[model samples]
Target: MTAPARYPVTVQFGEVNGEPATWAIETLPEALAAVPLGDHGVFIVGAVDPDAFDESDVSVLELLAANAVAAMDAADRRRRLRTYEDALKNVDDMVCVLDGDGAVTYATGPFVSWIGADDLGDVAGRPLDALVDEADAPRVADAVAALTDAATEAGGAPEPTRTVDLTADRDSDRRSRHGELRLSRLSDHGAGVVGSLSDTTDLRRTRTELSAERDRFRRLFDRIPDPVIEVVLEPEETVIDGANPAFEAQFGVDETTLRGRTIDALDIHDDRLGDP
Candidate 1:
């Protein structure tokens, strides 16, 4: 096995006495020259003319160094972008990317499916508004504006979220479904927006059902003949929130005076009241 290198690996410019053979660096007795390519590596040219090699040759090699470094940087960027695209494929949420003009440029497989598109090709280059329902256009516009404005103010801006009603297809506009949209500026991707959409149909339905049940319970609590008091139970205390008219009259205490105070502070509950 090859032993781990103990010395820090580095290259020195110009022809100098060093262990080039062990490091695999080419050395020429005639003329060996090199230019630093930033931290990437060094551009080495050997077999240079012993007499013709001068400062002008170093200047030309410097020019080549700039172009070579730029090529390496571009190649590195392409590699990272490929990795990002690969990672996005494994994400479950619907992912959408917009261009500088607010036109849809890219969509992951999940996003394409969410839009009811046959494939990504069908969804590209369309304005975001084209894919969403007309009724939700105003909210979409506002969220987009907020995202863009936040991005402009700071590179690391917080994501803005909004709930938008959606439809299967652009032409349908039925908008029978809903999604929670969390969006942020993709300054790294472009001066564009990258957003994930999660379906919230079940959540919205649950909220609606809960509101209806609360209304019904409030009606029942108001009309019932028994004395009733609504209290928020906590680990340390039970805070009185509401008292029915029967409870207030029977206890000889106005709800306004009893409300917002814990049971212990009021000192009215008997030992039986704590059994439940």
Candidate 2:
């Protein structure tokens, strides 16, 4: 931001040259006329006689340079924004940007697809709650608000919210899709919050089904008429982890006493362990 000696620079941010102020003036023998645009080029106006142009002309050059610098900076910002938009379009997971009030300012393709919007226009300006069900909407809004508030704190750094499950708005069939949401405060969001969402409905359903299968197996194990127990075979000993109802009843030992205990530590008579 500092100006050059005598010449007064309006804007230049590439790199600082160690060249002295007298360097430019020394290039031209006649009137005060020598300007270095950048490392590659120099503008030297040497008049046949002295006093060809006044100090006013130099001020005009400074103004021109400043304007060019401003224009370059604006163009750079536009280019970066285009690149970001392109990236968001190709992403499968959703990215949401909320304003300070927890309203959607920007949304990625995934979010747009979920809301059945043809484009961002239909999705933008909506509250974060619009994507999630009523019960989950409040939790999402509160997390975003908390991060936005934390970012404004005097000297504290805002932390991302823990990944939580969110149920999407019910579809025509009244079926809900689940997603894992993580909220954060990014510099790009300014005073707002950024939310990342990954669809986990299929994974969640698989886990639930697996849990049900385990429960059915447990019930079958308990109904076995013979004394049955499940044990972990360790290097040193077999450890009892589970015992069926018949085993627990015949052994006259509670499930808690049998669990986590090695067979040698149980002190059961040898006749009782005949089948084992």
Candidate 3:
């Protein structure tokens, strides 16, 4: 049987004919078509005979090549995915990805551990806000909605940082956790949000304690009989930064009047004046 024109050789893929051909071979159109009429019909042009080639032998070779290509493609895809997964896992912040409907698509390792989940499988594809307490679920939804809208409006620049307060079931009790959430728009037009969730229970408690302490200090300072003065020591600048109510009453002074006034001009017991 006549053969087609001698095809080129590929380093990884052997030549189409016994004789050497061009270094480059087109895969899609040029390589596949070899005909005397330049049509789909088979024509004899090559120095070698393809008839001597066994059907099974050629089949096996093609199959192996196809399988190799498929495997390589799959490996490349997996590697890319793994690279992203590793990046997400290494991040200290809780990173979560969600679909347009607020369903969880991918969640990082931190979130799984933070929520005490063995893996993301349980949460994957689930409505993320469902995990939140009913009282807070609506808020989570709202934040997600706002983030989505903002991203759409910004042409996917990235949603601005927002603080979301949500309740999670931790140790069998509803615990409030504050998260700084940032949303990103996915190529598929879905949205993904990633940020850190810090257990702010301690921070809130500390703030409350500090507030109480401040109130206590204010009460003590206000009740003291002697006029306790707080001066801006540096620059020798003294505008009453703070004045106790007692200090005001004793001097027949209003606290507002005491503020922003030079100490030298103020009337005080002359005995207290000293060389500065």
Candidate 4:
């Protein structure tokens, strides 16, 4: 393998052997002629006719240098952007990109983890609605279409953001994930739309669990054997929705009187019912 390069080098305009019009540069002759430099050691001069020096020559050199710098800058910028994009693709969550027409341009990660085999493999350039559940697909499609329309109509400013759920196939398994889909205008070109998607299955699962827990509590309150009572205002009466067999035997009161009866008239002084 070739050895590493040495220290850095600097170049700038300077006198070429005391001849102001005799243009030359200072640099190693073997290094690169494409780069403006004087000579191989210290500084050197290149012979150019004095009459050739003109405003046009200066402008040409300036343009050449500017073009070179711009090319180099563009190359570096592209390299960095590619590196960042690769990193994003490797992320754990499913990521999908969509165009202005709601067609998927790219898909990565385990989309099937939440959505089972929905034929997501040949997904490139396919509309997102196909992979989504029928119930939720139209809602999400309308939202995305609206975003694209607004983006086109919205002179320069970016369109407002929106989030929606979507489905996809992953590894022969059909899964349903809470996908957060975002719609944004891609730069100033206005040629297409760029979409970003993230999986939120865990959040949805947690919400479902909370709903189940609330239902469980309601069931317990309504079906328990204890003589649970509820008080009502306005008429000031008590309602008995739940009671055990022992409640009637111990209180010596019929079920009818126990329900919708004014508590003050019952005169329940027994420590068995409450602490009297």
Ranking by TM-score: 2, 1, 3, 4
lDDT by residue (49-76, candidate 2, tens digit) is 5777778877776666556555654555
Per-residue error at 225 for model 4, in Å? 6.5
At residue 266, candidate 1 shows an lDDT of: 68
Model 2 misplaced stretches (Cα beyond 4 Å): 1-86, 150-157, 172-174, 233-237, 273-276
Question: TM-scores, in order shown?
Answer: 0.59, 0.63, 0.56, 0.43
| Local error of candidate 3 at residue 162 (angstroms) | 2.9
What is model 2's C-alpha RMSD?
Answer: 10.1
Could you tell me the lDDT of residue 81 within candidate 4? 40
lDDT of 3 by residue, 175-274 (tens): 5454434444443232444434565667776888999999998889888977775555548766666777766766667777777776775788865543
Better of 1 and 3 by TM-score: 1
lDDT tens readout by residue for model 1, 183-213: 6666432246677888877888899999999
Question: In candidate 3, how many Å is residue 263 off?
Answer: 4.5
Give the winner by lDDT: 2 or 3. Answer: 2
- In candidate 2 the C-alpha lDDT for residue 137 amounts to 73
Colliding pairs, model 3: 3-43, 3-44, 3-45
lDDT by residue for model 4 (1-276), tens: 232254233443566788444322333234212334222122222333435445676566656666666565555545554554476577765655566677766566465334443444667677777767787788767666666644456554445556776654344464445677665544333223455667667887898999999788767755667654444654455545433454566676675666665566565665767644
Q: Count the backbone clashes (under 3 Å) in each candidate.
A: 0, 0, 3, 17
Point out the higher-scoring one by lDDT: 1 or 4: 1
